[model samples]
Target: MSELKILIVDDDPVTRSMLKHTLNAHGYLTAEASDGADALAKMAAETFPIVISDWNMPNMNGLELCEQIRKHDSEGYIYTILLTSNNAMEDRVKGLRAGADDFIGKPFNKDELLERMAAGERVLNLETREALIFALAKLAESRDTDTGLHLERVQRYARFLTQELVGDPAFADEIDEEFIQLVYQTSPLHDIGKVGIPDSVLLHPGKLSKDQFKLMQSHTVIGADCLKGAIAKSPKAKFLHMAHDIARFHHEKFDGSGYPDGLVGEKIPLAARIVAIADVYDALRSRRIYKPAFSHERSCEIICGDAGSHFDPRLVAAFERVHEQFATIAERFSEPSELPGSAEPKELEMVH
Candidate 1:
């Protein structure tokens, strides 16, 4: 692997010299900036994965520099490590609040600096991988679900479900903020492999034949393969790989009754299992060529009946709490075919 480019921003020449020598000896390439202005200029010229900057400088100090970096880009993350002579609690808090990835006390230990920089590198790599994964997810959604709104609605439903679960004491730690946000953003890709399924099956107006049902099931494998292929190209993308697991296993049931793989109970990945309930609920309540949409109440009844039989009981409980949000989502994204008098199902209310 090529050496990571490190940018040093310290007014003191001696400190820069020592850092450069220490980092070079450890096989990292170094760049120097006497002040924040120079550092920002250098940053614009070339992308440096890690920046070690002294907290106090003439103009555009390290804290300001970190804030500016945070504002400027969306594609790549720049890790800023602040060097501080000030040991005040407020000073450290300010630096972190301004976006410095780490703050090192003045007279920083060489080994500690190296360790912190390594940690910063890990964070930057993770950010880059996430960007790539999200891009691929967008591509997958665009290809399969023709309407641009499908992804939005699915993600919204996932977020609502996750938020409801996180609020409950039982799932607070398990569905932390990061996991909830990731699942909310990536859950829409569950149907990505529908792109690979023939339109004849995907757009059929009636129930699928046994043979066609078998073929339709291949979408899970196909979607997983697409993401696996993406990971083969970019091995650092861990979240994309997680999304692949969701796409492949979301259909698997809690009672060993679902498609592709019949994973049962906790055997299914938690994220995938959560997504399965959300996906089926949305699919049932949304209009599709094969069937008219079900009423929100009937959809809830169907899902409630399947607790522990087709879904995780805990998630089903969560779903029950947030079922109203699902109705809101249906109202927001109901297709034209699902509008009033459009092949009205017998049991559904004709909500005008």
Candidate 2:
């Protein structure tokens, strides 16, 4: 019901102003771009729910901009409306083929345009809510510099494990598709508490001393507290509750030796247990400032060796069943190899 942010891209100043004022009068926040190139620039710098672009422009055409927006794999979806003076049916079909969502012919009707904009706003609201939720998980990934890609890779691995568990005789009855997805999406926040941990301990180049290690272990509690605070504000945030359990207990050991709360065996949350194995495996295989990366075979050996002690034996068995899936995730997000002092972050933008 609030104002929807809409971008108007047109080469003619008169047309752009008319559309902006018309849309703004209907309770929409407006942004304007003179050409397709400027529109793309705005698209990168900010988030817009819908783009109303003119077909003909100086640099790139509306169709080209539509194609570019389609290619970006990100959180929010951009509903594009191409403005064209051509009224031919073939031109409209071509525009749709080129990725235009809804086309408005030039000499557009104010009422028709408003109706289309309303529908686009409804679709965008759902996308915006989903984007906000995923953004929180991204924040967890941001805190741990060395744990880069752990949040991403583990989600894929968790999905695979959960999917398999849903078919297993022991877990099939309790594990449903919805439960699996919620766990997959929310599991990455398992280490969200690390945000509260000091960089001296988190970014230390070597193993932590006894006290430092104990202090480092408190991140689980901190993460849970932070997630609890968020849920306190919005009780409808069911995912946050799931994330709280995972964050608080992911470090717990199967043999009851892990930190914060030494939960044993099946006593720990299943979501936490699943993430624990995947986290450790990804951590061992990925490069970090403190330790060198280990090979897949060696990391697998360590995981299987510590099965009864470090992880739940049943979950470890589930992991072995989906080891290939883990390998795929690792290879997909694998860190580039670089010699000492020669590494640089591959110029990747903060997406979503």
Candidate 3:
């Protein structure tokens, strides 16, 4: 309803015109592209939430377009519906593998097309929410010297560790498909409170003095306060609530030594516990102004060393099982396939 635009991709001008007119008549905005190549070109100029593409086209085809979109686009997920004459199961399978969300057969029915579009709208709206969450976290990350890659790397690492925890006796109830997904989506904000820390403390190239260190520790509270405000406005948003927990408690240790509340053992939020492992591992591997990046082996030993004191012992076991995977994740930015489809982020872009 917010002036949603649909991109209509087809080689046939007649078909394109008809689809464009039909969408426009229903109070929707539309754009036209002659083929998959043209559609990609259009995307370079602007992003469309929904794309209705024909299966057969000159040069590149709809399937290729969907694959390309899944690979390159991260501003948000694009809901793609293939308009094809082929109704065979194999064709649908191919389209799905290429990342098409829904489909409409050729000689489209006005009613059926509308139904598919409605389904796509629902999916796109969900993606928009995820994008906004990432954008807000990026906003907070911008206040720090480290690139937003810090968030991207941590998100995957958290998700990787969390997925392996599923069904373990300790996390039998807490670790599910949904929990794993929300953690991946919301884990990046663990340091969102750093936005409130002054640069003298946050960006200090040297070791912090006792007072400076104390000031630095307050970032957990700062981030939580920001997310708590958002939660108040959207009381039913589970992700926002999870983000608040992560921002406030990720630094809390399994023992009582951690700050901002000194929650010990199971008292720390499970989301925070998971993110702490991820955040620490990333911090150790990433190069800081004061310290060079630690070797993967050294980072592993440190995390394993802190198992009972700083991290959940069960999660440390999980990390051991996935240590190689964690190292792989550090080298790139991608979430596990168990969550929604992921795209490689080019770099940290500030959320406007």
Candidate 4:
């Protein structure tokens, strides 16, 4: 899609015309509406990513318009800005409660309006980046038919374990709700380096030789190295930094024996450690060319037995606490070939 279109709504023709002209001069494609009702009618026929509405319009006011937009489904964020004369705290609270993103006081300068819109555009860009990241991860996973829903399952499992860790005294400082959600989004990219691997190796139906296995293991470093340049350029992008850590260290073991890096115990980044068990558990339960599907009981035993070896003991304990959630996710997002152990099999979609 090209740049998103904006909707301008106001009861006064003068105010609506001024906004339309000003935004168009700023290079924004805009559509004008006489009032909130007209704006909603236009929205029903077409999508508007941003809605700029006057606070007091007849038939349907801006507050009601904002609330209605919030209740409607949108493919992307529909940021609403209210043009209001009131600068009082109570009015601001009411506008926010009614779902407005920001309030632009009446008689506002062009610079102020443009600045607010620029901030809103930045948020929309971030959401676009996240969606593209997920799509790219899915593209990488799609190469191997056996890997159906692997990315979704691991991210969900990782999210569950990370969420549980947020309350533990050991991880309270490092794990929070935002961090858990980031793990859910970035975990899918852990194996994104597989995109660089050859079809012959990736689609093989048998075990790879030692050299091929070495080539396969390079996916970790390959993914990390690729993300390093991205992090250097963005510097402040926390998601890229976490992605780099996860892509590089997810294969590293708790004991100093696993591949790519011999990171042991607390030496491994916490996010990588959390995803390690998630990836392992999902691989064990899901059928693959190299291994038959292991029963849930056997899979759990392997994970529990490897505590302090294949995974962090604390995360293992976290896993023990949320294993049922993991099992539910596994059954819900099983391979396409496997019968969905749940009543509904779902494809994960972005929530804008």
The whole-model lDDT of each prediction reads 0.75, 0.74, 0.79, 0.79
Error (Å) of candidate 4 at residue 92 is 27
Tens digit per residue, CA lDDT, model 3, 57-164: 989999999877855534565778999998987677667656677789899988898888887777566756777778888887777745537887788788778756
Error at 96, model 1, angstroms: 21
TM-scores vs. true structure, each candidate: 0.58, 0.59, 0.63, 0.62
Q: What TM-score does structure 3 among the candidates reach?
A: 0.63
User: What is the Å distance of residue 195 in model 4 from its true position?
Assistant: 1.5
Worst 10 residues of 2 by lDDT: 343-352
TM-score of 4: 0.62
Candidate 3 global lDDT: 0.79
Estimate the lDDT of model 4.
0.79
Better of 1 and 2 by TM-score: 2
List all candidate RMSDs to the true structure. Answer: 10.0, 11.5, 9.3, 9.5
lDDT of 3 at 52: 96
Compute the lDDT of residue 47 as modeled in candidate 1.
86
Residues 1-352 of candidate 2 have per-residue lDDT tens digits of 4477889999999999899888888788999999888988998898887999999998999988876675442345678899888768767656654556677878788998988888777656554544555677688567665666667677767766665564455664656544665776677677777778888887777656888878888989998998888899989876778889888988889999886788888888888888888778776676676556666776777789888998988888988877876776677676565111211222100000
Candidate 4 residue-wise lDDT, 208-232, digit = tens: 7677777888989989998999998
